[model samples]
Target: MRLIIISGLSGSGKSVALNTLEDTGFDCIDNLPVDLLGAFGRHITELGEDAANQRYAVGIDARNQPEALARFPSILDGLRELGIHCEIVFLDADDQTLLTRFSETRRRHPLSDRDTSLSEAIQRERLLLEPLHERADLTVDTTRTTVHQLRDLVRERMVRAPFELSLSFESFGYKHGLPPDADFVFDARCLPNPHWEPELRQLTGRDEPVQAYLDQQPAIAEYFEQVRTFLANWIPSFQRENRSYLTVAIGCTGGQHRSVYLAERLGEHFRAERGPISIRHRELV
Candidate 1:
C-alpha cells in the first residue's frame, strides 16, 4: 500500500492538498492524530489488496499532542518495515501571508486563544511541526499561489509516475519575495528591462513584443544557455538521488517580462528532455 502524509501550517493549503489528493483517487483522512499513524498503516496493510483502498493520504498538523507528534519518526520507521511506501508532503507559507489569509477569511488560528496573538500562534505551530517539516519528502510554499494554482500543483505532483522527478519552472518578482520552495533561483533583473519601453510596458513576456525584445538581447541568450547547461548537468544527479520534485525559480524586478520569458523558454527547452514539467508565472497568475 502507498501512504502519503500531508502535514503543514494552518492557512498553508493543507486542506487543499488533501482534497486534491482525494480527487486524484487517494482515500484521504483529515486531521488524523499523530499517535494513530502506526495503527492506520497497519490497518491499511490488513486491508489486503483491496484495489479501491490501495492508496491512502492523511492530514496531520499541530492539533495533535506534542508528545505524539514527536514519535512520528519511529512510527514511520515501523511503517516502512511493513513494506508500505510512505511519502510526506509539507506545505508552508510566510508569516505575513498566513496573517493576511487569516484576516481575509476571518478565521481564528488553530492554536490561538485570548492569551495568544495570531503571530504567536503561527510561530508556535511552526515549532510544533518542525519534526514533520524536517522529514518532508516535498515542501511547497504557497505564499504567492492562489487556491486554483495550489490545487493544480497538488494534483499534478500526486499523479506522477513512480520515481519520476517532476520539474517546475516558476517566475516571480524580487519585489514580492523569493518562492520558498525553489531548489534553484536565477535572477533576471540584470537583463534588458522591457518595463521601460512605453509600448511594451503593458505587455508581458507571453506577448510577442516582449518576447521579441528579450530574444534580441545577447546577455539574455547567454544567461539562458548557461542556466540550461547547469541544470542539464545537475538534474541527473537529483534524479539519481531519487528526488520526486524540483522547482527552479527565475525572478526579475516585477515578474512581468524577463523572468516570465526565461521561465517559459526553460520550460519549453526541458519539456522534450524531461518527463513532466510545470511552468508558472507568479504575478500573472
Candidate 2:
C-alpha cells in the first residue's frame, strides 16, 4: 500500500494538500495521531489487495505530543519494513506569510496561548517540527502561493505514482530572492545581458527577438550545454535515491531575459527526455 504523510506548519496549507489528495482518490484522514500510524497501516494491509491499491494520506501536525512527533521517524522505518511504500510531503511558509494568513482569516494560531505571542508560537512550531522536516521526501514552500496554486502544485507534484520524480525549472532574478524549494541553483548572471541592448531591454527571453539575440551568443549555448550535461549526469542519481521532486533554479540579474530564456530552453529539453517537467518564471507576470 502507498502511504503519504502530510505534515506542515499550521497555516502552510496542509488541509489543502489533504483535500487535494482526497479529491485525487486518496483515503485521507486529517489530524491523525502519530501513535496510531502503525496500527492504521496494518489495518489497511488487512483490507486486502483492492484496499491496499488505494492510496492513503494522513495529516500530522505539531499539535501531536512532542514525544509522539519525535518517534515518527522510527514509526516510518517500521512501515517500510512491513513493505509499505511511504512518502512524506512537508508543506511550509515563512513566518510572515503564516502570520498574514492568520490575520487575514482571523484565526488563532494553533500553538498560541494567552502568554505566547503568534510569532513565538510559529517559532516553537518550527522547532518542534524540525525532525519531520528533515526526514520529508518532499518539502514545499508555500510562502507566495495562493490556495488554488497550492492545490495545483500538490496535485501535480505529489499525487504521482511512487518514485516518479517531478522536475521543475524555475527562472528568477537574484535581486528578488532565491527560491526556497530549489534543489539546485545555477547562476546565469555571467551570460550576455539582454537588458543592455536598447531594443531587447523590453523583450523577454520567451520572445523570438530575444531568443534570436541569445542564440547568436556562443557563451549562452555553452552554458546551456554545460548545465544540461550536468543535470543529465546527476538526475538519475536523484531518481535512484527515490527523490519525488527536483527544482532547478536559474537566476540572472533580472529575470526578464536571460534567465527566462534559459529556463524555457532547459525545461523544453528535459521535458522531452524526462517524463515530467515544469517551468516557471518568478519575476514575470
Candidate 3:
C-alpha cells in the first residue's frame, strides 16, 4: 500500500495538503490517532491487492499524546517492514506567518490553552514534531504562499506517480535567508551581478536582456558549468539510494539576478534527463 503521512504546525497548511490529496482520489483521513496507524495498515494489508493499489493519505498533528508523537519514526519503520510504501510530507511556515495566520483566522491552536500563548504553542508544537520533520521525504515552507499556490504545489509534488524522485531548483536572496528545506545550497554571488545595471535592475533572470547579460559573462559561464557538472555527477547517487525528493537552492545577493538565472538553466538541463523537476524563485514570488 502507498501511504502518505502529512504532519506539521497547526496553521502551516496541513489541511490544504490533505484536501488536495483527497481531491486527487486519495483515501484521506484527518487527525488520525498515532497509536492506530499500525493497526490501520495491517487491516488494509489483509484487504489484498485492490486495497493496496488505492492511495492513502493521513493527517497527523501535535494534538496526539506526546509519547505517541515521539514514537513516529519507529511506527514508520514498522510500516515499511510490513511491505507498505510510506512517505512523510511535513509542511511548515515561519513563526511570524503562523502567528499572523492564527490571528487572522481567530482559531485556537490545537496545543494552545488558557495558560499557553499562541507563540508559545507554536514553539512547543515545533519541538514535538521534530522527529517527523527530520525524517520527512519532503518539507514545504509556506511562509509566503497563498492557499491556491499551496494546493497546486501539493498536487504537483505529491499526487504524481509513486517511487519517482522529484527534483526542485529554488532561487533565493541571501537577504531573505536560506531555504530551510534545501538539501544542497550553491552560492552564485561570486558570478557577475546583473543588479548593477539600472536597466536590468528592474528585470529578473527570466527576462531575455538579463539572461543575455549573464550569458555574456565568462565567470557566469564557468560557475554554471561547474555547478551543473557537480549536480549531474551526484544527483544519480541520491536517486540510487531511493531518495524521493531533492531541493537544490541557488542564492545570490538578490534573487532577481544571477541565482535565478542559474536555477532556470539547471532546471532546464536536468528536466530532459530527470522525469519530474520544478523551479521556484523565493524573492520574486
Candidate 4:
C-alpha cells in the first residue's frame, strides 16, 4: 500500500494538498492523531491483497500531544516494517506569509487562545512539529504559492507513477527572493541584458523577439550547455537513489527574460530523455 503523511503549518495549504490527493483517488483522512498511525497501518495491512494496491493519505499536525508527536518517527518505522510504502510531505511558509494569510481570512490560529498571541502560537507550532519536519521526504515552502498552483503541484508530485521521478525547472527574479523549494539554483544575472534594448524590453523570453535577442549571445549557449550536461550526468544518480522530484531554479535580475529562456531550453532538452518534466515561470505566473 502507498501511504502519504501530510503535515504542515495551518495556513500552508495542507488542506488543499489533501483535497487534491482525494480527488486523484486517494483515501484521505484529515487530522489523524500521531499515536494511531501504527494501528491504522496494521489495519490496512490486515485488509489483505485487495487493499495492497490502494493509496492512502492522512493529515497530521501539532494538535496532537507533544509526547505523541515526538514518537512519530518510531510509529512511522513500525508502519514501514509492515511493508507499507510511506512518504511524508511537509509544507511551510515564512512567518510573515502565515500571518498575512491568517489576517486576510480572519481565522484564529489552531494553537492560539486568550493567553497566546498569533505570532507566539505560530512559533510554538513550529517547534512542536519539528520532529516530523526533520523526517519529511519532501519539504514544500508555499510562501509565494497560490491555491491553484499548490493543488497542481501536489497532484503532479504525488499522483504520478510511483517509481518514476518528476523533474521541474523554475525561473524567478532575484529581486523577488529565491524559491524556497528549489533543490538546485543557477544564476543567469551575468548574461547580457535584453532590458537595455527598447525593442526587446517589453518582451519575455517566450517571445520570438526576446528569444532571437538571447540566441545571439555566445555566453547564453555556453551556460545552457554546461547546465544541461551537469544535470544529464547527475539525474541518473538521483533516480538510483529513489528520489521522487528534482527542482532546478534559474534566476536573473528580472525573471521575464534570461532565466525563463534557460529554464525552457533545459526543460526541452531533458524532456526527450527523462520521465516527467515541468517548467514553471514564477514571476510570469
Q: Pick the candidate with the highest TM-score.
A: 3
Candidate 3 lDDT over 1-285, as tens digits, reads: 689999999999999999999999999999999999999889888889778678999999999999999998889899999988898999999999999999999998988899999999999999999989989999999997899889978876787666777889999999899998899999888888988999999999999999999889999988889989999999889878877788999999978989999999999999888766888888886
Per-model TM-score versus the true fold? 0.91, 0.93, 0.97, 0.94
lDDT against the true structure, per candidate, is 0.90, 0.90, 0.90, 0.91
For 169-233, candidate 1 gives per-residue lDDT tens digits of 99999998888778999999999899999999999999999999988999999999999999999
Q: Judging by lDDT against the true structure, name the best candidate.
A: 4
Model 2 root mean square deviation, Cα atoms: 1.7
Instruction: Sort the candidates on TM-score, descending order.
Output: 3, 4, 2, 1
Model 2 C-alpha lDDT per residue in residues 28-123, reported as the tens digit of each score: 999999999999988888788877667899999999999999999899998888778888889999888999999999999888999999999999
Residues 1-285 of candidate 4 have per-residue lDDT tens digits of: 789999999999999999999999999999999989999999999999988889999999989999999999999999989998888899999999999999999999999999999999999999999999988877888887899998988876788766477788999999999987788999999999899999989889999999998999999999999999899999899989878678899999989999999999999888887746788888886
| lDDT value for model 4 | 0.91
Residue 144 displacement in candidate 2 (angstroms) = 1.6
Clashes of 2: 0
Error in Å for residue 284 of model 1: 2.0
The parts of candidate 4 lying over 4 Å away from their true place are none
The candidate with the higher lDDT, 2 or 4, is 4
RMSD of each: 2.1, 1.7, 1.2, 1.6
